[model samples]
Target chain A: MHIEFEFSGGYGGLFAAKPLGYRVETDELPDEVRDKLLALIRDSGVLELKPAQATGGPGPQRDVFTYSLTIGEGAAAKSFAFDDASAPPAVRPLLSRLRELAVEQRMRP
Target chain B: MTFHKCNCHYIPPHVLGNMAKKGDPAVRQAARTSAQQAKLSREKRGVQAPKVPEMLTGIAMATAPAPVTAAREVYDCQNKWELRVKLARGEGDPEFGDDDVDTVYGYAETVRGYFAELGRNSIDNAGMNLRLNVHVGENYMNAFWDGDEMAFGDGDGQIFTSFAQSLDVMAHEMAHGVTQFTANLDYYSQSGALNEHFSDVFGTAITQYKLNQTVDDADWLIGNEIMGPTLYGEALRSMKAPGTAYDNPLLGKDPQPAHMKDYYNGPNDNRGVHINSGIMNRAFYLAATDQIGTQKAAKIWYHALQNLWPTADFDDAVEIIVESARTLVGDGVVPEGTTQTVRLAFKEVGLPS
Candidate 1:
């Protein structure tokens, strides 16, 4: 899924920079988002993020990102979380650099 | 190359522009390079990387249930809203009043009353039957709606409690379902805020109705029951007072803005939709509380919610209420102080001021 963003607010100015939001499908992620998602994979405490690409694609896209968030997949954790947990990290920071990248993309005129 | 997100993180687009157009080249370069490198990396990585299982991807991804690759491994919790029910040694014990029945029935009863009160007796309350799972993610410190069902975690038994303890909380999660079915409001930004607003509106209404209290008697707090018993946090947010919703260090102070003037901006969490909902909540609070004399006065707030609210954004909501007020109260009489109060409150927030 390659999701295209048709912003509601529309870049207000010739130089308006806004985060282009989209609905996720899981398998397809834009190039920038995929990079940071992947970056988190090798960071720490993360072993691997299973076939979530096809899952995280938010609209239409060519590829997916690599997310390395494996907080509670243990026996105890598995019994609790929903059958489909989120791939993206909620307490983001380690991905601050990636976020900045996303910010930059939004800022692009 | 964008991440499909609603982004309610409070970092507005103009701010990003400031960082880019005015900030140091290092910041701009860093941002640009990150975007560039990410694109290059995606091309390099392709689809080879395995995606994370769907079972553990919420805020508490660290402690989500493992993916069930099997065709059928449903942990029914047997309609029992109790965690201990699942731990019955060898399953020979009698069926416990896990509260699951009560939870399910409670939802049914609430909806029944809701429709009756609004003459929506035929709206089919069964459209959303809450499938709550208690004691999720073992000692997990978080609970969230996963676009489908509602799941609760035994909050590390510290920072929070079982997310199921709060009726308003349950109503909040269930409200997400209503949004998904109705407007399918995007989960971040204005749409996200609208989404949260719906939940808060519905959740608060359901709680109030369940308690048989009108708007004046109800505490306009969202997730008051979901707060950590050990900490000093009020409900997740206070419609009466936005910024002061929470003042803890762990989750940080609540960033919710009571008025549109303070509306947050960001790319994450759909531009802080959840935080921005405070504005709407406050609007409802102000509209209802501004009233002077009323012993058993009916609530236009709930009337708007059950009979009028649209799954859509503020504008759609306003239109619906204005119309519903007409239908509920009069044709040319106009709604009472409560109805006007909502509009005035919205105006006060700088939305249309």
Candidate 2:
């Protein structure tokens, strides 16, 4: 599922809509692929990553999602989660539009 | 092969053969760990972009460094969101100079060029690649390196400005590249904090060096501009004192631990690696301690960071600094005995035994 972007930007950002969580086939995946996924932790577009939270208690929870990223400096072992806030008007409109378009495209099939 | 190359030069103590009889498990563990990290760094280094002599889009042979940091191109949303077209530097056609919110991509485009230019000048043998990705998130307060590329964010502005406003932050992020290409320290616990501290130490240190300022002259704050204008504190992390950077009501106090005995531990990826990094962050300050800009100070740190800190954790880092000082000045009281002084300074914070 796709996650909705909401709140202020960056790590402490929140999600307006619920995140579309996916369970990757971890054990079967190759190291390079795992590395690539870990790299995405630093990516900004991502929001509401639950598994990404490695430390500190959760802040005002609004459907927190977990995503794994390299933690504490560079170790891939630090799993951390994030708080999901409402998306701002500057970017949320775009995501809602995209979501609508996606549904339309799927329904066309 | 006996010397495992992780950070600088890690001599793996062979328990089975050579000078020392079966070394204790501690030594063995150190050797094995260094060997493992060495293998990882080697593997990661191997993944370099394959040689491409021909330019894909006329980037061509590198030109002379720009006279100043230029904001060449800006892409409003109407333009294509393609990185290649944007990177193919050129004068504006239709969309280049508007700061319109609808097309704010121009600022990011300029940052991209800054990195591209930096990448060419910083040679591979020198061991670095300039990396940057802007427009990171909605209103991200902080930006950092994840052992690879640089990330930027539009700050909360309540406590900071955009991340780009601070050159030291850029230096700090780039130093991560230096750290990755060099020591490749395990980014957790003390080593992790060292990783953070080095980034800050080297980060702010380079900024001061580049700006031609001395230690007393340097502000010694990390991500100063990233915080909002209203905030009383100056930076995200302070090399002199970690958690003391900010104590705003919003983000709460910075929680970086200051000493080894006070080190934070949790299952969270080698214990709050980032939080605990304050200890080693303090160590580097103590190591570099009094002398800020002199070549002598940088030299001692360079020796330790380059030759000594290969796989050193907190205590190990202090040991290496002492060793590095001895190697640099050799015997009898060297000014501050940079290495010895570093050890002493760290002892002040309870790092070195």
Candidate 3:
């Protein structure tokens, strides 16, 4: 499975100059890494996470990041956006992996 | 009152979290590390030991004057997440040789002076110890008031810089502490916006007071000096024109709306607390500029703040401020027309009393 994702929200949207986004496929990774990533995603209940509305309540949670993820594409695409402060335990690994991919994508020449 | 633990942050989580996604390897690593540290901070909260009950060491004599003075402690996180790791400076320590430590110390004292000038003690209005942790994480690009203390980050040196370099930024975090002690506005919607509003207000006020600048002579920009040279933005936010702080290639246009009609109803940004704050900020600016000036306007708002509750929204703010104006005027504190000027100011921002 391939995942498409985007993340934003920070000091006045500074990092958002270009959102980190890319497609990550299992075949593109080393065998063990791919297996670990896939397993983490599968078990993390990322698919069950309901879409989180865009809102970071003021107070302690101010300026927190928000994420949008799509497990598939086109009409069959399943997308969800969530606040970083409220990321579920099962979804954290996926979030971490996506961030890693996004950074790599962003650094491309 | 329960001293609520607040995750007060200088750099919004989204900003730091984004660094984890799309920067150079070092940037991404720092971002990820800082994010993890921030998360761990929450867990640390759970494990925090309850404060030992205050020991009754001695009783004060009635003839002795009560001693109340600012007490401060500055710690160095040493580019790690843990707070209070190494003692860097203290209230009366000699120069620590670190610009971050010395700068935060000076700024904190200035903020303390601002409050003391108004007869308010420290964050708790009872001279609570001021605690700060600097160098929070490697390339960390934010600072915040984390409920009991303040945290500063050494910026990534590219997109952002050290948070300690800016007095207004430091004052902004200090102002957050003030709100926690005063109205303690809820961190949702309008209340959150108001919380941000007061911080911005005092942030600018302290800056102006420090510089000895008249209202008109002030720049009215927040975080302009500390934004570093990488970005083309002028400042983080502008009080004179809310949405006009910056419009750069990287950060897009400022999203703040000066009127309720342009209020942001989107997600993240704590229900646009920082964004929508432009409205109230502009209102305060207008009121302060013409009718009452910054000093009186600050006093009026400070009074209104004391009268507010956690859930007070924009409408409630209008009512409380107008009432505060009346009370201040009735006591011959401020001249007449203060209330009218305030009402007209809010009305201009679509919040009529």
TM-score against truth, every candidate: 0.55, 0.55, 0.71
- Candidate 1 lDDT, A4-89, residue by residue in tens: 22221100000112323333322566776666655543462223334443233222111011222223333422111111233334
Output the worst ten-in-a-row residue range by lDDT, candidate 1 chain B: B67-76
Candidates sorted by lDDT, descending order? 3, 2, 1
TM-score of 3: 0.71
How well is each residue in B1-353 modelled by candidate 3, as lDDT tens digits? 12223322234356678887997976775565455444444442433322223212222122223343457788987876456889999878999999888888888888888887766778766566788878875665566676567777787676578987888877888787777766778766789889889988998888898998888999888878777776635788889999888876545577888999988887655577778889999999999898587878888988888778778899999999999999999988788989899999999999952
Worst 10 residues of 3 chain B by lDDT: B54-63
Best by TM-score: 3
Error of 2 at B94 (Å): 17
User: Weakest 10 consecutive residues, lDDT, candidate 3 chain A?
Assistant: A53-62
Best by lDDT: 3
| Candidate 2 structure quality by residue, lDDT tens digits, A40-96 | 433433333343222322221111122222233233333333321222223232332
Q: Is the docking of candidate 2 incorrect, acceptable, medium or high quality?
A: incorrect
List DockQ for all candidates. 0.03, 0.05, 0.12
**Candidate 1 lDDT, tens digit per residue, B38-151?**
333343334332233432344334442343211111122432222224432111224445553334334534643553454332121222223445655444433445543555
Off by over 4 Å in 3: A1-109, B1-44, B47-69
Q: Rank the candidates by TM-score, best first.
A: 3, 1, 2
Candidate whose DockQ is highest: 3
Error of 1 at B43 (Å): 25
Output candidate 3 Cα RMSD.
Answer: 12.6
Interface RMSD of each: 14.0, 13.1, 5.9
